[model samples]
Target: MSETHDHSNEHDHATHTHDGKPIQEDPLPSLEAQILEASVRELLIEKGVISADDVRRAIDQVESRTPALGAKIVARAWDDSEFKALLMSDSDEALMAFGVDMRPTELCVVENTDEVHNMVVCTLCSCYPRPVLGVPPAWYKRRDYRSRAVREPRAVLQEFGTQIPDQKQVRVHDSNADLRYLVLPQRPAGTEGWDQEKLARLVTRDSMIGVSDALAASDIGG
Candidate 1:
């Protein structure tokens, strides 16, 4: 009898394993990209194009911002009709009233209603309202989300556990360098007498991004 050989097994063993354990490939691209970015930043600083202090200050400013500020704005809007009107018309002014410094980038507030649902995305890049909502989430910066958001917003929202009825209009906003979007989620029912502070607790970061709805009355021990 001739000895039988399994070439496919040999090939798999060679490519996918070393000794008895599976070979793990080095995931260095992210580290390499970070190193390249640091190198470029150092070069720019050396060239006097931008100073180290400038970078530090910018980072500090970004770090100082948080989603709580956005929640306050949303809650105020939900409680006060006049503020909601102002927010929809001029978000910067409305935010300024709350002591939020949203300069340089114009904020466009999209209101979610019974008839219309809104979603925000940055197709070109992750341009977001950092002053109001802090840094964009990692998932938001992904190319897949940016592309899919505009292409199929309802489906994207569904994945985020937000189900919009077919009868309602789904509006997708693409944020750019000059303009960023913030979604004003509809006020939840059964909270008619809720104060701004209590209402703010119901406004989540994801709701402001339009990926989820405001916390229901039952969600926050209400």
Candidate 2:
């Protein structure tokens, strides 16, 4: 993908994994960066800029950010039409329900439908929707996926065992520092009369990434 982002053109899925399998974890930062972080943390504590407790709390907060949050958002969108419209329109306002603040950056929610499939990638870097989807899967941050997703999305999706029909258009969105995206996958069938909580079980990280569809209701014995 080019550095220039053109949202107008429809572009497509690199999976964090296939069929909800556990994806490889993202690698740690470079040793230099790690050392720098530690030094900065200690210096802050020494200078009374922040407490050790504060550091621990911040670590916990980052750890707590996960795909489950995004799943809840998707499930809510499926169950509540009004909220879904808000998400598709004013995403920041809709995200308020989850107590998420996307101030310096904006979250754009793209939906996958029968006619068009969608995917997210950061060609420039690993700019992801962290507050909503947590850390991106390791593959999403790799050079191969970053480059190939926009060029050969259908082939990439095939590698992930996702076969989009020829009739459906595949669209790829490039994420950046100031803008991020989350794929609002289509709700699966056979889920009538399901509550939000129960419906949430069908949502998965890969589906929200647009690499695959939500878990079939029968998959969970629903």
Candidate 3:
């Protein structure tokens, strides 16, 4: 196994282990739990802090797909050398190329490297590039991933079917602040003169999350 990150003292799974036998945990919460949850919602509604429409809108926003927009930006970066340079320097401009702008928050930075890989994890909470990746999956929100990734990124990547070489460096990003991150993975081999549409297929959600690299031709039968 290769070392995938820097140990310069920068900033910064598994299963339900029960008794000897396999003990199935409670699948559903008790009736009391549901009632309590409902009561909380009722109280919040009564206080007028949030309305049904607001809740529905929030749900709709998460369910909406904005992946294509980000895909277009990434595809452009794959092909255009000048744009890639601009992206490394100014991500907001790079993102604007795909019409995805991070206006209020300019702290977001896109880091790129050849040997070491980058991945973003908000272990404390579900911090994400909602405008680009839309909403995050449930697992990314868990405290386990957020706490462990910054410590043992290699192990986390393995679970995602991504294993870094012992020689390579792995940089696990802890998105503990308002600054968000997007990975600019290395272009996979055997993809010479490939078009944007073809290249977009290689960029999986895992690649964006930093757990896995972009797909190479061999992996996708190219």
Candidate 4:
């Protein structure tokens, strides 16, 4: 279930629409946070720090980046070994090809192996890789998940309908402000000779989040 090790900095999705638009689950800001944000925006506008048009453009850009972007990265990794090596080692450099900059924080890519299954959680707060994954789910930001994920991760996975094999070791990674984790899910079998586009379709936001495996060939009627 859980292991005792000095994994202080060990780390690091689930459901989502397959289209370019990723569903934001209860993404509304709290009243207090909203008020504070509005006040800050007004102050910035009043001081000429930023114009209203700038805000609109920024929002558009953020919304434009979706899980599809993450899917493309995962697909390339599955198809090309060279790209996978670069993604695992130099994520920032690899992500630059997608114009994603993990500024003020670095991305730690974790791979799910035959013996180990990886899951990511932010114990203190939700520090996710928004540049690629878009917004975090509402359940992710809840107190229940933050506490239970480290304490009873297997149970949590089961709740998400993911049942791991008994022989596999479940390792929970905790994400912090400076570092964010992304799970590079193991590609399914029977996908040999598949192109990147076909492979990308198998990659889901949930798989990259480590809550589930990538869509199998059978799932896609392949």
The whole-model lDDT of each prediction reads: 0.81, 0.83, 0.69, 0.81
Q: Which stretches of candidate 3 lie over 4 Å from their true place?
A: 1-55, 107-112
- The number of residue pairs in model 4 that clash at the backbone is 2
**Stretches of model 4 off by over 4 angstroms after superposition:** 1-30
Q: 126-221 in candidate 3: lDDT tens per residue?
A: 678777777777677655676677777888888888878887878778676767777767778899899988888887766777877777888777
Question: What's the count of clashing pairs in each model shown?
Answer: 0, 2, 11, 2
- The root-mean-square deviation over C-alpha atoms between each candidate and the true structure, in angstroms, is 10.9, 8.9, 9.5, 9.7
lDDT value, candidate 4, whole model: 0.81
Q: For candidate 2, lDDT tens digit of each residue in 57-175?
A: 98898778999999999999999999999999999999999999977999999999999999888876688888998878988888677778888899889998899999999998878
Which of candidates 1 and 2 is the stronger one according to lDDT? 2
Model 1 Cα lDDT, one tens digit per residue, 1-222: 102334444332211223321212322234445777899999999999999999999999888888899999999998889998998898877887877766777888999999998889877667888889998898887766877888878888899999999999998888856888899999999998999999999999999999999999889998
**Model 2: residue 123 alpha-carbon error in angstroms:** 1.3
Per-residue lDDT of 1-222 in model 4, one digit per residue for the tens?
Answer: 012223235321122112222222322234555677899999999999999999999999887777888899999999999999999999999999988999889988899999999998886668788888998887787756776788888998999989999899999988956888889999899999999999989998888888888899888888
Which candidate should be chosen as best, given TM-score against the real structure?
A: 4
TM-score of each: 0.78, 0.83, 0.73, 0.83
Could you tell me the lDDT of residue 104 within candidate 2? 90
* Ranking according to TM-score, highest score first: 4, 2, 1, 3
Model 2 residue runs over 4 Å out of place are: 1-29
